[model samples]
Target: MTTYPGMPAAPKKSVLPTIAIACLVIGVLVTGFFVYRIVVTVPGTPQPIEAGMVHLEKEGLTIYASVPVLTPACEAQDASGNDVPLKGPTGSETITINDDTWYVVARSTQPVPAGDYSISCTDDETSATYAAGPKSSVVAFVLSILGAVFSFLIFVGLGATLLTVGAVRKRRGNRPTNTFPGPPGAPSNYSQQPPTTPQQSNTFPAPPPYNPGPNPDRPQDR
Candidate 1:
């Protein structure tokens, strides 16, 4: 659209809202990731893994050992004595309690209903340190959760601020405006000129008329 000079014009449409939405979506996904981590191990009480029946509060529990369980070397069973499915973890996550360390080994791929289960590992013999669930102190766990929440808020705030600014600019651009005329600009290549005066003639008539009259009177008398 045509616009007048000094007039506010609507800004060009942008993909900022799209970008903001993307940021929000990614933020939620990331936040969910933290939430999942917190949920998986946070609530479970740490119990020593052994050959006999152990009380497990949640399913998909991580199998921990001093060494990695490379295979389905470890397995579990439900309350009814049926063998439960277990899969080794894709990555390593560990926790240390009282200077003793236990690494994750395997977990249930699907949710197992909450109850007691018998945990058995074929190759693991280090019975003293074998354990499952989170071992981090209460303080560290709280900090990690706070960090996730802080990151989520930052992303959401950024998106919301961008959306608000864009909307305000668009509204202002669409609004009608008044522009007061300003003082005229100086002439281009102009300069001040000096004043001009009329010129006078330099020549004047001689006194010859008087001499010619005297000579005429003298000739008449002769």
Candidate 2:
């Protein structure tokens, strides 16, 4: 097919919509996974303390420990057995499972270096110092959840923008190109037909009879 020199080529199909859809699907899947982790995977059975000492490690700024009952005080120590002052609880909550009660604890604002650590708690009722068992960090879990939420929002926003742009382009591509003549009263460049002249009627005068009278007077006797 011949293309005019200045005429625009047909618009190509947009890839933006496909990319947007892919992003949306991926974002939803990732968001769902993070939500599942926050809701179902984060909480775990509390480890019991033994012998006034528990060995553990820190993944973030703080470490957490849970106990069966309320304790008067708690503290942590480095692997070298140096006493580290326990930061105030970032979070503490009571949870019950199978008729047993547990206190979930989180550490303070200062981040602890990631490594082995020991936890010790003092019982208020018995004045006994006890060691806690290996446990997970609540602060790390909470941070993970927040990070996931932020990522999900970004993915959704990007996907929505791409989809909107693609849809607008597609609509423009589908619109019909106008090639018809202008309205009846509009002026045109073509030459106009000349006006017709009116036809005239034919008329003629009658001829006179031949005259031989002068010569007829002498020739009439013969």
Candidate 3:
């Protein structure tokens, strides 16, 4: 049988497309998990205010107050008595439900490295309650959710691009290739021809001159 001793055949398809699909799947799962972590615990348990002073920690510590407490009337300070920077809530829920009706009065969107903290607010009838919790802040929650989504999007985008590249590579890999040249004397375009063999001679040779009993009739000429 004929064979190509010098030709290299096309290789198998690429695995990049498969990798892209897996990446996309993983991205979605991760994004879902992160968002869930931030959302499932809305209005997270917080440190309650005691005697107008509440010790809080973390940057996103959200301050929650009773409906009657004016957000602007509240202030916060650290253990060193230095005023803790506070700003109006941005991109956070105005109200959350925990043990009672609480409104998000103020918060700091900037990463305020608020360590231990104290709160001072006028409780005219001492009927208002206050607390601080990072999870309670809607702004922080939304930002976290957005971060997760953006990460997912980036992964998906890369996956999609890789998948496209893989598809093209696979198509190229699957294409037929010619590794060896055609037979000798073949046209440049190439064409097959049946093999041939030498033909046998047909005519037979004449018998040698009558070799009858040479000495029978003629005397043995010395």
Best candidate per lDDT, number?
3
Each prediction's TM-score versus the true structure: 0.43, 0.47, 0.50
Candidate 2: where are CA atoms >4 Å away? 1-46, 60-71, 90-101, 104-110, 113-118, 124-154, 157-161, 180-222
Q: What's the CA error at residue 59 for candidate 2, in Å?
A: 3.6
lDDT by residue (177-203, candidate 2, tens digit) is 644344578554344579999887686
Put down candidate 1 lDDT per residue, 120-148, tens digits, no spaces: 76664444345554223344566669867
Query: Which regions of candidate 1 deviate over 4 angstroms?
Result: 1-37, 40-45, 67-75, 87-93, 96-100, 122-128, 133-154, 160-222
Better of 2 and 3 by lDDT: 3
Superposed by TM-score, candidate 3 places the C-alpha of residue 65 at a distance from the truth, in angstroms, of 1.6
Say which prediction, candidate 1 or candidate 2, comes out ahead on TM-score.
2
TM-score of 2: 0.47
**TM-score winner between candidates 1 and 3:** 3
Better of 1 and 3 by lDDT: 3
